[model samples]
Structures are given as structure tokens and as C-alpha cells.
Target: MLSALLVTGLAACATQATAPAVPGDTALGPVLVDAKRMTLYTFDRDNAMPGKSVCNGPCATNWPPLVANAGDMAKGDWTIITRDDGSKQWAYKGKPLYGWVKDTKPGETTGDGFLNGAWHVAKP
Candidate 1:
């Protein structure tokens, strides 16, 4: 009986561990963060109509998009977007999400309102 209970507890813990982190709001406002709590951003140059990402090549190298895995799901305002390279990325409210390379710490908003207002933090 104890062994069975231990197995059950381990299964539960494993399930929770594999669950993807969801976008949440912080003191800066509603923003998407990774498991490490790093802030996510969006680019204004990217179009919202076709549900595609325009930040590629060098742009993508500087501002990495929040990649989505095969197991990730779309819920509420969160959705997945397929980049031109055919990789899945996370998007919020139809905008492709990204992580600025300049942001070194959690809750850092240095990328917010960047590039003459072309970039802004992803808000819920």
C-alpha cells in the first residue's frame, strides 16, 4: 500500500512538472514570462492579420520569440503561431511573443517601449 501511494504521488508530481508555464501579469502590467520569470515582448512591425511572425534572421537573433512545444496548448488569450521557419511560437492576443536578449533579469522592463515605441512588453 505504501509503495502504491508513493507511485501515485510521483506520477502527480511528474504531471505538474511537465505542465507549461502560462502568461501572467506582473507589477509592470500583464506580461508573458518563461519558467524563469523573464519578461516577454512583442514587435509592432509584425502583422496581426495572417497570424505570422515577421521578426526573423537578425531580428529573431536579437529578440527571440517565446517558442512553443508540441505539448503546449492555447488557452484564453494565449495562442500558438507558426513562424516562417515552420517552428511553433507562442502569441498573445494575436501578437507574436518574444524575449529581448538585453533583459538579463526577471521583471526587467528595459525592452518596453523600445525602438522608438516599436517594441513593447506583452500584456495580458
Candidate 2:
């Protein structure tokens, strides 16, 4: 029964096309991606801001925002917001965190690019 429950729980997570990081909880460490969930998380204080994402257009296609759900709020340093498209996303320290689609693995920080050298790993 325990194994069945675990499998069911994991399956539910996997089916979420856009899974946001759970508020108040830091990922594995130093901004680790949950391969099972295909989500990114960062630990930092996020100032309330809406529809303002540093990554947009092509940038957004690469680093997808971890969408948030309604009733979500800042936990510790994390905050939630509704994007222009009415989609939910997580932000930290007033900056939205994203996951690089090219990052095919948990520890892959492939999003580190020149983009004026602004993109970086989401750190706690």
C-alpha cells in the first residue's frame, strides 16, 4: 500500500504540465530541479510584482516559469504572481525564477548564457 501511494503521488506530480515549486520549501539544494516534476525552485525574498518577468519571448521559451496556483502566497522568501496571460509563476527577491528547457537533467545549469550575462543559477 505504501508503494502504491507513493507511485500515485509521483504520478500526479508528473502529469502536471506546469508544476510550480511548493512555497516555503527549498528544492534539493542550491536550486535543484525535480526531474519527476519538471519544475525549478529558488530560495529568496520575492517582492510582490505582477506580469513583470525578466525572461520573455525567446527567453521564456527556454526558461519556463514554474506556474503557480490560486490561493498561493509568499512562503518565507517565495512569492506567487499572475502573469499577463493569467498564468501563475513563482518569484524570488522580486525576480522570477525559471527552468531552462535545454537543461535535460536535475543538475544541468545549461541556461547560463550571455544574455548580456544576466541569466544565472537560482540560488537560495
Candidate 3:
């Protein structure tokens, strides 16, 4: 079965609309999207670390984490977690968010069910 993160009223992750870091209600259901309405995703592998992410280097190049700026802080449901590399990341209820490279346009969810179902479209 496909898993979903049911977050409502979006907790944290406010990069102030820079790069469009916000959840959006779209045709693909209640999934997160950036400013340009690009679909966002979450990797099940990152769940192994709870709110932290493991998709670094090449993995990151493919699925970029929904990053946080230097002063970004957790608010309501959103929280910031430091990666192994000491960089900060945005997490919703302890799950890190990401974007897929293959999604060439807004609302494209090509990464859903990717890697034998290790990746899924992030829900809100």
C-alpha cells in the first residue's frame, strides 16, 4: 500500500515563500508543492532517521531536500533537523520533505512509488 503523511494546517517549513516552499492542494491530491507548484516527495529511507534525511550527495542530486535557510525555525507542525553534514532541513511532524528530479513540471509526480516503492509523494 502507498503511505501518506496526513498533515493539516501545515506546521513549520516557512522559508517565506522563497523557492515556493509550501504545501498546495492540487489535482494529485493534498500533496506539498513549491512556489511554482512543483510536486514534492518524501523518501521512506529518510523515515529510518525519523525526522532527519539520508539522501545525500548523489541521492540528494536526484531528490533535493526541501531545504531551510540559515534562520528557518520550526513552527506549529514544521520542524528543522540537522543532517549528518550539519546542514539544516525542513521536516513536518518529524518527516523530511524532498523534491524529485524527474518531475519536470509543476504537479508532475514521477517519483511516486519510485525505487520499488521506497519513495512517495509527500502529503499534507
Candidate 4:
């Protein structure tokens, strides 16, 4: 019984570790983050109305999309988008979300208002 309990505890921990991070309030305002709490962003070029993503190829390399697992489900304002690569990505308010490669730490907003305002930090 003790060994079974231990195994169950370990399984719970593993599930928590792999769970995707949800949107939360930060100094930059309410924003979506990854499991590590790194800030997520959105591209102005992408249309939020139809939930379209235009960041691909080299653009995608610089700003990696916040991917969603097959098991992830849409909740409230958060939704999943299908990328051109056929992978799933996370979106907020119909706008596809991304993570800037240059942001190395949590709560960093270095990618905010970048590229002549084409890129901005995801806010709620």
C-alpha cells in the first residue's frame, strides 16, 4: 500500500510538471506564459478575428509560437490554433501567441512593441 501511494504521488507530480502554464497577471499586465513563466507575445500581422497566424519560416525561428499539446482544450479567452506546419499553438482572444527567442528570463518584456510595433506582449 505504501509503495502504491508513492507511485501515485510521483504520477501526480509528473502531470503537474508537464501541464501548460495559463495566463496570469504580471507587472506587464495580464499575459500568457509558458511552464517556466516566460512572457508570451503576439504579432500584429496576424488577424485575431479569424484566428490566423502569419509568423512562419524565419519569422517563426525568431519568435517561436507557443505550442499547445493535442490534449489541450480551449478555456475562456484562451484557444488553440492550427499552424501552417500542422502543429497546434496557443492563442489569446483569437490572436496567436508566441515567445521571443531573445527573452531569456521570466517577466522580461524585451520583445514588447518591437519591429515598429509589429510585435507586442500578449495582454489581457
Clashes of each: 0, 4, 4, 0
For candidate 2, write residues 1-124 as lDDT tens digits: 9999999988765555433443222333456344343435322222233436645567568677876666555665666766667787877655677776776755555555435446656654
Candidate 4, residues 1-124: lDDT per residue as tens digits?
9999999988866654443556666677877788788988989889744687899999999999888876667777777889899999888878888999999988888899899988988875
lDDT of 3 by residue, 1-124 (tens): 1233323223333334333356776566878887678888888888776877989999988988777777565777788888778888887767788888888888788899999999988887
Determine which window of 10 residues in candidate 1 has minimal summed lDDT: 15-24
C-alpha lDDT (0 to 100) for residue 77 of candidate 2: 60
Tell me the TM-score of each prediction against the true structure. 0.76, 0.59, 0.78, 0.78
Q: What is the number of residue pairs that collide in model 3?
A: 4
Best by lDDT: 4
When sorted by lDDT, best at the front, the candidate numbers are 4, 1, 3, 2
* Weakest 10 consecutive residues of candidate 3 by summed lDDT: 1-10
Error of 2 at 119 (Å): 0.5
Q: State, as a TM-score between 0 and 1, how close model 3 is to the true structure.
A: 0.78
The TM-score measured for candidate 1 stands at 0.76
Which pairs, if any, clash in model 2?
45-93, 46-93, 68-88, 114-117
| Candidate 1: residue 101 lDDT (0-100) | 93
| Cα shift from native, residue 56, model 4 (Å) | 0.4
Q: Give candidate 2's whole-model lDDT.
A: 0.57
